[model samples]
Target: MPEKTIAEFSVKYVQVMDEKGIADAKLMPRLSDKQIIEMYRLMVLAKAFDDKALKLQRQGKIGTYASHRGQEACQIGGVYALGKNDWLFPAFRENAAFIALGFPMHLLYAYWGGDERGAKIPKEFNALPTSIPVGTQLLHAVGTAWAMKLKKKKSATIVFFGDGATSEGDFHEAMNFAGVFKTPTVFLCQNNQYAISVPRSQQTAAETIAQKAIAYGFEGIQVDGNDVFSVYRAASEALKKASMGNGPTLIECFTYRLSDHTTADDAKRYRTEKEVLEWKKKDPIERLRKHLEGKKIWSSRKEKELIDWANEKVEKAVKEFEAMPAPVPDDMFQYLFAAMPRRLREQRDYLEKYVNELRREKNG
Candidate 1:
């Protein structure tokens, strides 16, 4: 037989807004004015959380923290598109997503302060605690989606991970299973350009992360991650498709990491200042603010009010987190199982006695 091409594919790129704040009216999604304002506010609130966390980490009030500085649009826009019944499976650094999903900011603060209770998601919210391992939650999200499908539920599942995770075997396994099972899931890859000093270029030779979905028998789309409208539209469409039994979709959010990887690392050691400066111009909040300004709904006064409101809210959350009672170290042993194992129980008893003896000695 003659050599022939059996199939061909092209990835779609969605960008409803430009860096200068000009939006393509024809491509704009059907979002209400209030929704637009809420989107901007959520992004601002996420930024406030990131800034506060970084400061707290510096002051030793919190452990190492990751800041979602330049990727607010990608996080907030994707998460805001989710319905109440949908479930969110997030990797670490999804502060904007959590805020948009209505996760209490104080609990989030407490989580970073090394208290696992902060991650104890409420029953009403269908969100899992942030997964610290790279790409592992992809499998978890796929499993959840498979369960939803088996139950004939109308809900969908969205999972978020960084660009570097694409190289992990778990990502491929999850994608393969999700495709084969026809699970209602959306794979959201926030291509923030770098994954802990490893640039996206080094992570994969593929031109775009969205294209990876083609091999898994699903549609994939890339969007301007810094453009809130674009990310929202793409995510909304993908989620709707999934819920309607169209199977999974991969949304590659082409964004940037504006801050260092975390409190323990310095970005200055690897990337250049010029590159960082360029991405800063594509600030998601500023772009949305510009669009609001063009619509005559935003002004300097509104900007001040929003900033003041965000600051006040963040301060209140900080106070609540700090004022919470200290956690009992023994409590960790109680939550692991319904009935503690003999070995673990013995270890717990030893720790309790040691702690008590130290306390008594200090008192003496």
Candidate 2:
């Protein structure tokens, strides 16, 4: 037989609004004015949270923290598109997702401060506490999605991870499983260009992360992660498809990280300032502000009011978080199981006695 190609595939790139605030009307999502502003507010709130968290880390009030600075559009836009019942599985650095899902900012602050109780998600919210290890949450999301499918539920499961995670074994396993099983899951990858010091170029040789989905028998689409409209539209569509039992989709949000990888790492060591400056020109919030300005619904006064409101809310949450009592070392032993094991009990008692002895010595 003559050589022939059986199949061909190409990834779709979505960008409803360009960095210059020019929007393609035909491609714009059918979002109302209220919904658009709500998306904008959520992004602003995420920025407020990121700013305060970074400052807290610098002042020694919080442990090492990740800043989702320039990727607010990706996080907030994708998360805001989720239905109330859709479960959200987030990797660490999904502050905006948590905020959009109505996770209390005070509890978020507490979590970053190293208190485990902060991550104890409320019963009403279907979000899982963000995992710190790369790519692991994808499996968990797939499992929940499979369960939903098994139960004939009408909700999808969405999982968020970074670009670096796509290279992990778990990413492939989850994608393959979800694809074979046709699970109602959405994989949201925030391609912020770098994973810590490693750039995206080093993470994978593939042209786009979304294309990886093709290998798993699913659809994958890339979107301008900095453009809120594109992110929201893609996520909304993917989630709807998942809930409707159409199987999985991968959304690779092409965004940039304006801040360092975390409070502890300096991005300037690896990437160029000029490169970052260029991405800053594509600032998501500013682009949205310009679009709103064109619509005559936003002005400097409104911007100021919004900023003031966001800052006030963040400050209030910070105060509430600080006012909460500190977590005891015994807290770890308290929550593990319904009944504490004898071995763990012995360890907890030993720790208590050692701590008390140290306290006495310091006092004396």
Best by TM-score: 1
Error of 1 at 30 (Å): 0.6
Could you say which candidate leads in lDDT?
2
- Tens-digit lDDT track of model 1 for 1-364: 9999999999999889987665577889999989999999999989988999999998999998989999999999899899888999999999889999888999999989988777788888889888888999999999999999989998899999999999999999999998998999999999999989999989999999999999999998999999988888998998998888889999999999999999999999999999999999998988899889989998899899999999999999999999989988786676557889999999999999999999999999
List runs of model 1 lying over 4 Å from the truth.
333-347
CA lDDT, candidate 1, residue 150: 89
Per-residue error at 118 for model 1, in Å? Answer: 1.2
Which residues of candidate 2, in runs, are more than 4 Å off? 333-349, 359-364
Q: 118, model 2: CA deviation in Å?
A: 1.3
TM-score of each: 0.96, 0.95
